[model samples]
Target chain A: MTGGARRADPKPMDVDALIDDPGTKIVVCCGAGGVGKTTTAAALALRAAERGRRTVVITVDPARRLAQSMGLEELDNTPRPVPLPRPVTAGGGSRDGQAARVSGDGQDGQDGQGSLHAMMLDMKRTFDEVVREHADPERARQILANPFYQTLSTSFSGTQEYMAMEKLGQLRQSGEWDLIVVDTPPSRSALDFLDAPKRLGRFLDGRLIRFLGPAGSGTFRLLGAGMNMVGSVVGKIVGTRFLNDLRSFVAAFDTVFGGFQERAERTYRLLRAPGTAFVVVAVPDSDAMREASFFVKRLAEDAMPLAGLVVNRTHPLPTGPGADLSAEWASTAADTLADTHPLAVAALRSHAERVRRRERELWLLERMTSTHPDTRVTEVAARPEDVHDLVGLREIGSALAGDER
Target chain B: MTGKGGTGKTTAATALALALATGGGRVLLMEVEGRQGVASLLGSAPLPYEERVMLSAPGGGSVSVLAADAEAALLEYLEMFYGMRRAGQALTKLGAVDFATTIAPGLRDVLLTGKATEAVRRREGGRRSPGGPHQYDAVVMDAPPTGRIGRFLNVNSEVAGLARMGPIHEHAERAMSVIRSDQARVHFVTLLEEMPAQETRDGIAEVEALGLRPGAVLVNMVGPRLLEGVELTAAAIGELDEVALIDGLRVVGATDPTGLAADLAGEVRSYALRHLLELRVRGELEDVGRPLVELPRLEGGMDRAALTGLARRLSEQGVRK
Candidate 1:
């Protein structure tokens, strides 16, 4: 049990303090799949809102339960007001409400009653909105109509990441919410939340688009004979019409969004801004922790402002006076009681199992802290039931804020 | 195999491969997501695009793994189908490979499904020839998660509108046949959680709508049930007999028996609540009408031994080898 003990314990992450800070305009929760990134982001948003900072949360791919918890029945692409169940306390629960009021930036005065708005990212619709906002109606229609754009808008791998950033940019520029919490797409693609915009930009402006653009584009002319041979081979493989549609789509997209790279770069810089904080969420398992470590390092490499790591669903040692009971003792007692006390045997066995799980979780978290010593971490104890409502979200919020049971 | 993310889809696929490989059967465990999850689960180095024996089960059976990516599959497709290796290189240089695989992922899916189905169709005698002894007894694909599996496996329909008359189109058609044929079984891996179970049900519906065969619904990471029947219900409602619990702990020669009993009672109550939820979810999953195979939760995460243990469990649960 003491195997995970370190020379000095890692710093505990101050989740309440982080959310309560007015300077923290954006909190992006990113992690691998099924690590409760959406739930964390939602809980943080709800916490931020109840703490008197108007917040909006954007979930890239929310399960129905999350949407329902936020009072959203369907994904409607735009932010809809989530009726904040009235704060239990009169003056709100935040430590420093004065700072939030001082930093209110002349937005809608909710009279210190913080508001929360929730939205699910409709990736294709968001892409269409970008086109509509940037391009003229005709070019937008043309790009929208193109079969290649249709597929790229909806089915492409990095499009979700790109659209997420694009939507984030739109939300930030709107300046309607004091805090914006973003639930990124799951898995390695969550890191794409940072890289996807640039990748999409690079892809859009890459030589392939130039080669496939049009027959007489200036860049194509520069390639000369080798280009023709390659073009013919590609033509033979993908069919001439497919290439033609791609060319037209690329040409139109280029004309519409002339400097997507620059916009992507802007969003990238925005993420690195002091106002933003990246929280990498993970469960106690090795796979999720590895991904979380990768995400932490990725954020560090990119100079992004990382707040901390949230280890969700951790099996902490059970509370009560008997918490000090050793696993070995419990198992031994269970074995001795096997004949006489079936219930005691079952209870002691379960206690041993829980103790073993806690040890394993601690070991995994210790490995992470040892590797990323500078990273702050907060552990959310495993809830017995699934979190699917506002009350559940509040419980998670309390756990996140280090409120010990 | 498909399931919600982190539903042990990869682990289930590996175990299923091991199960199918049980009797000297050669099984190809392929992952298209490029996570190299199979490699990691096998505790081996990351697998390359080529299929190689990653693990050997008992009875002389073996599991070969392939971490198939779209770019490699497309390059291979171009080379094998059109003899345009140099042209494929050109595409790579020009980033058309990236475009085809990443920017337009339908084509990527087409190539990926094409590669998997190509493995399914490949004969032992030669690369070009169609008829011979089967190369592998069974091919298990760790496919995309439930959310995207319908579109991932429905390659031909997605490509039909894009590549109307090319080798890509023809390749997608071939893959679709293998996918839609009786040979394929799209197994779904899910936990007894609301979201995963919901996704499994919906995923089955989507796959069935795409005309793919829905196989077993594997419930992974099912937790231990401490109490059952009337006691389980009583515990769930916070009505556990505390005096009996404390007496039992005292009889076991426990120190601070009262405190320990209270702690254990709390644990039991929570477990009962969770068990009830799991039972509801289990009922819903059973209503999905597929064979539901439940795998117990493997504590301390998965390793090679636990994976093989899961394979044995699958066999015991009547999963066909």
Candidate 2:
């Protein structure tokens, strides 16, 4: 089916089938802000674990709701086990007919067969940890202790993306869980997350380290004295101590540059690896779709595997013709209640406008998929009830499974 | 134009236009996205391009508004720059023009900046006409947000590495002249929120790197003073009364007056302290070395009264120039 027609034989949420596939490991959920990406990540993980696969979900949202949804008081970078229902399998058995419990240790274990773990990243803390992990303790401590480094670690300029990837790499290498699901921070441009690793990596490799490298030993230092003389003059005019402090910080981190560079390269490769899949999540809005399209094109350029697209909070148009209650209601509201209840009339009009906009968005998305055949599209109906607990998540999972709205 | 969204760049542009108009200098406010944010904020409909549509404020100032849609602007830009309609059609069909004009990262900035520059230059007597070419004394642009603002304003430098010698390169150089000149200024609008503040700081750094001086930093939606004097002192003390304190101590053998009052006071004190800390953080913004102004949050949404009040506050803050 094509051109806005509903798909025949809609695919239900097959957590077991997805977990069993060796090719699938990473599940990335992305969307505009306030679209429930954190809850979606929790639900997907819960569903995977319910199917008897050990799963871990990570969220980069600064909001505490991720921890709150999982019934936890707080969350840090480290993974914590989520208390699953005691009897393991829900509804008695696995629905996909796969083994309820695998017998291995690394891949899966006997009694710990079905488990769930979750982590919420403190981006700045994670960045600091990475520095401490890779660099000399003293050097890392010095950098961490620096006020500028502390600010830059948390400050904007494509740093959050780098930190997100760093956490992803840590989780991927941990071998602690069967499935890893990551929720990215709401970005101004969705593609920034994908481009972040490269942008930051290049900055570290090309400009930052060179400018900050040792003054007397490295190649930069040999040329540094002359540059410094000129820089001093310019720096005075600019009234900033950037060059001086930058040089010191770079010199301090120079010993660890090789390690940092290698790790960044590894992380970049892992993102492009076949085991990783990018699920571009977006709402059905003109601006959101525009950003999503840009993200898809960027992903293609990077050669990262596109798993599918999840269009979240999609307004379900009344499937049949009768849903056109809008036009008739609008006319009646206009005649009898225009001045008496303008707000009510206005709200009705807004709702109709929104429905029309959704139709257009669905059409555009259908057109996008036609050019790229492998890309699958899934729609999640807008939930009036907030998803804040396991029960709410189950409803969301059922929605994803294509249960009737 | 910056890449950062939701910043008050549009609002500042509109207010600045009003300010200049109030000072008896004709001004034009131009928007690139066709968003109607400026018009709506000013309580008017979307203004068409190249037309001097007047906007009247409660204070008796008149400002003209213009909305430059990308397609129409591109066609017009080509007509003016190349003096050929054929080039526009051929470029559009080839998709180079669209990509060059739209999908291009910095092109939007260039076009918006180019339009503002045209408005600025047109103020001087036209080559073919007598007297002052246009009535406007200044042109204000509600640029893109802070994230990409640097790249937008510095598109010429970004592309300079590629287009070294061409009409496009020449056009970029001309645009840069107006952008970097003293007559033109790019102001930034932000709230006191962590992310917006951080973005603003980085934006200042980046814009300076691109050799353009940022005009001012307008802190929009500034919180009103909610606590003061005796009530504030009482709240800070956790509602501890001297009579209750002594009575409770005598009856319940309560040794620590700090117990309930201390806990309550601690929470209130922390909340107040956090606001003070935010103010200190706002203070560090002074390091950017630009004029900083704060606009109090409107109790309601944007309307004529709020805009007038904001314009008055802006004048008091000395952003009227």
Candidate 3:
């Protein structure tokens, strides 16, 4: 798909079949902000579970609506089972990932046999967990209590990306569910999720860090003899106390640094693996489509598995026997009809506006498709209300699967 | 000002800058995120740390823009506080500047705030040469998104790790005072949608929690309120007639009136939903207790001219005053 003569149009992404396939273990919903990415991930996960796949959704979006939609008061770092829609809410089954995987036997009147678990990525908490799990108590305490470490753990620039990758790897290794759906973090650039681990790893192993690592490790340290001069130069400028503190923090973090590189590499390989499919969600606006195309091009460059595009809140053109009325004609007519019929006048005005907007959206989408000719796209029309409940999600799911509008 | 991702805060901030500068007062519009949002919004080249003229407002004033880089901020800080250029250069060599700005997000925010609020508090020109002419009458920053607005502005928290006495700590505390003082107001920009409205409510609370008063809520991209209080509820239930609309379009010389009718019917449904959603969002902003400014959705997709129109609207709405 990345390198070839492209078809006139890409295949529509089949969400249900993708989930049902045992080979597809990881589904990453990534896109620009305000493009309904969180909603797409939640709906896809919900649909997957209902279709008899033991699915767990891990969303890094800071928005709390995912929990709200599932009727859970909140979701933290740990995965919480969302209550099923069945009337027998007091425990009609579905406890573990295993028992929840029920076969199809017509036992699905209201609720599906599959299970859905969700967790909000708490980056600091995940970092804390990683430190606690990786280091001995004394070492972990020393590292965590360091002022620099405290700042880095809580508000470091690439921390969210690194921790999200860490969490994804943790979930994959936990062997809990058959399929896992991951939502990209709220970072403006969707590629941040992909670039974070490596960036974090580099910072960990970078020149300053190596200069600050234990003096004893200098025998093998590649900075080679000028390290002390560089260190002293920094120490002289920042004051010896601050440099000493930073050095100590780096020394304490050295053990975790190598582990970080390893974990990042593992996750990077996992992302490039065959089982992973990236679903880029976007609204039909020009900026959104441009970002979506950027994402497509980046994923292609990285050789990540591209599973087509999911265009959300798309404005479909008016379709009937003959839906070819030009917006200019509608505008002229609306202007003429404005005096007597206010409601119809307003309606015509809106018709003209909608037609113009839909045309722009199609023009942009075509521009995107022209660049990547074989890119598959599924268009989901906008919902009047926010999808706050499972029914709304199911409607979205049906829309995603082409079963409903 | 800040709001949720994709809430058009950058555009609003630019317009606000233009509006504030319309009275012959120079305004500095700073963007800290390196998103180049202000540059694109103003149709200027990518802004460096140096202040450059972006636009001259219609009335009389001018707006200057700056993408406040952390490194340049730290250098500026050093030059102003310590009077040592060599030490700043040395630190930059050690990657400490990069580490402080990009590596430590909180510290980077402190630098961003320290620089911007410094400009805000400046008396036209340098305080040393007091009353000659002001650098800017006001400073408007296109801050981080609503989710991190609190953290970005919380200089006290950023200083908490620095043991109470260092220059960095002192700088943070001073920045905190300026930010929390009556001199500063953190405005919010949001859309008339559920997520953005909810985020705006929470964001206002967060700003207040940081001991800062919230500013106006600039609601962007608002569509026309064609359906009134009771009309929306009626429209949502499919009561708006499609056939009559089709006949009216035919009578008015529209080609293919049936398709236009279908489009109008669908549009009415969408508009009704938006109306209902917008009504609830208005209530949410009201609960935030800040004055609200409603900017209409631009007709031809908010080009530079339309952005100027929005600035004029904001000025009319008394946003600058």
Residue B93 local lDDT, model 3: 64
lDDT score, candidate 3, position A207: 58
Clash pairs for candidate 2: B1-B149, B2-B145, B2-B149, B3-B148, B3-B149, B4-B145, B4-B147
Residue B308: error of model 2 in Å?
A: 19
Best by TM-score: 1
Q: Judged by lDDT relative to the true structure, which candidate is superior, 1 or 2?
A: 1
Candidate 3 regions exceeding 4 Å error are: A1-11, A84-113, A213-247, B43-45, B75-94, B123-127, B242-247, B253-263
Model 2 lDDT per residue over A40-145, tens place: 7777778777766677888775334446656455646766666553345444233121233322224443455666667777888888887887787789988887
Q: What is the C-alpha lDDT of each candidate?
A: 0.83, 0.60, 0.76
On lDDT, the candidate that comes out on top is: 1
**Which ten contiguous residues of candidate 2 chain A have the minimum total lDDT?**
A95-104
Report the lDDT of model 1 for residue B321. Answer: 60
- Ten contiguous residues minimizing lDDT sum, candidate 3 chain A: A1-10
Candidate 3's docking class is acceptable
lDDT of 2: 0.60
Q: Could you give candidate 3's per-residue lDDT for residues B1-321 as a string of tens digits?
A: 999877788888989988888878689989887767776665667777888987888768888888888888888887777676876775676566766777665667878888887787677447777766657788899998888889889866765654344666666777888898887898899988888888889888888877888989989888776767555677777787677777787798666677757767777877787778788879978887789997887645556788788889998997673
Off by over 4 Å in 2: A1-16, A19-22, A84-112, A221-230, A237-240, A319-357, A370-374, B1-321
- What does candidate 3's lDDT look like per residue over A1-405, in tens digits? 011112344567887788888898999999878888878888898888877766778887545655666644554687766655542234444433333422222233234357777778888888889888878899899988887777778777788888877888888888767778898887757777788778777667665666666676753266566555556544543346665667788887787556566778888898999889999988876556767888999999999988889998866655552245556766677678778766777776676666666666666677888898778888888776677776777788888888853
